[model samples]
Target: MDRIVVQAAAFDAGAEIASLREHDASVGAVAAFVGQVRDLNGAQGVDVLELEHYPGMTEASLAAIVADAHARWSLRGVTVIHRVGPLKPCDPIVLVAVASAHRGEAFQACEFVMDFLKTEAPFWKKETADGVSRWVEARERDDIAKQRWQGAGADEATQDKATHDKATHDKATEGTRARPRRA
Candidate 1:
């Protein structure tokens, strides 16, 4: 809760790491994650990327992600930075570093925050190929990734919605199968 950073420019991982370590002696480990812009998207190879984020909502959204991670685990310091605007291949897209008394908690918190950010964060990435750019939507892989990191016990409504959605989807598939196919 003491540290919050959300920016539209590329972040320096080494400098950030050093800053995190300063004035924090109780931390036994600092785990970090940095996401980059890859050059491939399906059939085409991406040459550039234009990322956009809601100004007001973006900060609030990332802060909420940090807060959620702190609430879920015992964390000492948390820092998250995501870049916007145009980016090239190998450019750092996001950074997440978590400090805790132990390594396990720090690692888990870092990964968890990333997974949640990929799925829940408001930033959007649009891959550009030969100057064509399109907004990337949430993917099934992202959802699955987030699902894997969900705490051992989740809230009642979330559990209920997951179960309810599955049941509804299953019934819909069954109904389609039971009906005659169109010629």
Candidate 2:
């Protein structure tokens, strides 16, 4: 089973992992990653983080990423949850969990999902610190991480689709940045 969610609500990591393992008896190892809103980005103290995305497009992109993982590894189960809206420091941002018969596949799939999510997803983030807000730029490190997976698990066709999807998304959301709602 594969579950993908994009919401403004927070998620329970333990419950997600438990649910992933509960339905499958063959799952011998479960690997998970929880990303939280940090209090600081380098020296700047972060007060709030806001994430936004195109509703239908974001979910479709995530499904493609999960499907690619399934194509690459023998995963028993996978769950991905990414939160949006205004978030405070220390708030949970995303969760990626994978269940497999062995540890290696589970670990690799979990990492692959996260790496793809960071670079390929349509999410936009803005960080506010000292009452000033700035949209977070795409990180070179994340692009590098995503590049390493090329030609690893997915074949040329799958890779081409991923590239096409990313290009389409970038074109669609070219100049848009999520703005904070005034209170």
Candidate 3:
């Protein structure tokens, strides 16, 4: 089973991981990544981080990323949680957890989900520093990270399938490039 949540409330990472493995004795390894709001972005000192997204579209994009992960790996379960609204430094922003029969599959799937989420999800972020707020621009490093996953999973057939699926997802969510302001 896959669990996906997009909410404004903070989440418990340990609880989420436990939930992913519940009643699943076959899961021998679990990999999880928790992203937190940073206190600084380069030279600026960040006071708060605000995130916004088109509700339904954001969930759909995350689901597509998880689906792609399943297509490439034999994952027993997956959980993804993303928080929106204003958050202070150290607040958990996102969580990606993967459970599998082997460590390799779990680790790879967790990393793949995060890489895709960073680029594919239609989430916009703004940071406040020294009482000034500015919209955060997408980083080139994230694009490079996503590109590394291309043709790099499972067998050739699976890689082709994932590629096709990703293309379809990208086409479906392309219009969301123009992000909306925080409501």
Runs with alpha carbons beyond 4 Å of true place in candidate 3: 41-46, 152-183
What overall lDDT, based on C-alpha atoms, would model 3 receive against the true structure? 0.84
lDDT of each: 0.74, 0.84, 0.84
Which runs in model 2 stand beyond 4 Å of their true positions?
Answer: 41-46, 152-183
lDDT (Cα) of model 1:
0.74
Residue 128 in candidate 3, Cα distance off native in Å: 0.5
lDDT digits (tens) for residues 1-183 of candidate 2? 889999999999999999999967988789999999988766565488999898999999999999989887778899999999999988999999999876656877899999999998999999899889999999899988887778545664575575456546645765432221111
TM-score of each: 0.76, 0.80, 0.80
lDDT of 1 by residue, 1-183 (tens): 346566667788988877877788977779999889887755465578888778888888878888878776677789888888889888998889998766656776798788988887778788788667777777899888888655355653564465456546756654421111111
Candidate 2 positional error at 29, Å: 0.8
lDDT tens string, model 3, 1-183?
Answer: 899999999999999999888899988789999999988856566588999998999999999999889887778899999999999988999999999876656877899999999999999999999889999999999998888777454654575665456546645765312111110
The residue-level lDDT of candidate 2 at 28 comes to 79
- The window of 10 residues in a row where model 2 has the poorest summed lDDT is 174-183
The better candidate by TM-score, 1 or 2, is 2
